[model samples]
Target: MQVFEDWNQKVKKTFNATNPEVVLTVSEAGSLLGLTKDQMKLYVDKNKLTKVPIMRSVHRYLLLKSEIDSIVKTR
Candidate 1:
């Protein structure tokens, strides 16, 4: 699947489509980046994706869609 499509599916599966700009969960981000869970965590640790804290001790990532679109184009 295309990266954007994959990302949308992941988001829907993991966290319902409350909003497109809504922060994606880690799993969704991984799918978007085409990375494994471990790699996704590493990217979080390395600050590749901006981390945003959520309620009840959960966290989410805010990814720039434009930035991702650029990467997709290059690939």
Candidate 2:
């Protein structure tokens, strides 16, 4: 019981620390943009879109939801 409580607290703290606000995975961003995952990568590489790094890992990136929304609005 005590261990479970501790783990729960830790999970809550981690979630709070991350405070994920409008972060989308590459696949998600691609879906929103009507592009395939490969095309999404290309877009990112071409600087047509920007990504937020996660855990300082090059392979893990998140797109800003607000940016996606803006693109939608423009279109």
Candidate 3:
């Protein structure tokens, strides 16, 4: 039964396509960059990072995972 459950989980993951582009929320990205969420917001604006805007929300957005990876690599 445990093995079956594990296999089922794997199958579900394979079919799940919720995050096709991979994104990080403000808090998540901020933690990675050692900044507070508000500080991160300012950094995003100052750096002109790509923001994946949420539907009907002007202030909420997600940052591209690829961009964050590149920033990490450079630093």
Tell me, by TM-score, which candidate is best.
Answer: 3
Candidate rank order under lDDT: 3, 2, 1
Q: For this target, which candidate reaches the highest lDDT against the unseen true structure? A: 3
Error of 2 at 49 (Å): 2.8
Per-residue lDDT of candidate 2, residues 1-75 (tens digit):
444554323433454467766566677778888999888888878866776665545576667777877877887
Better of 2 and 3 by lDDT: 3
Model 1 lDDT-worst window of ten: 53-62
TM-score of each: 0.47, 0.65, 0.73
Error of 3 at 67 (Å): 0.3
lDDT (tens digit, per residue) of candidate 1 on 10-65: 54445435555545555656678898767877977785655554434444444545
lDDT per model, in order?
0.58, 0.68, 0.75
Off by over 4 Å in 3: 1-19
- Count of residue pairs whose backbone atoms collide, per candidate: 0, 0, 0
In candidate 3, position 7 carries an lDDT of 36
- Residue 38 in candidate 2 has what lDDT? 88
TM-score of 1: 0.47
Reference-based lDDT, residue 38, model 1:
75
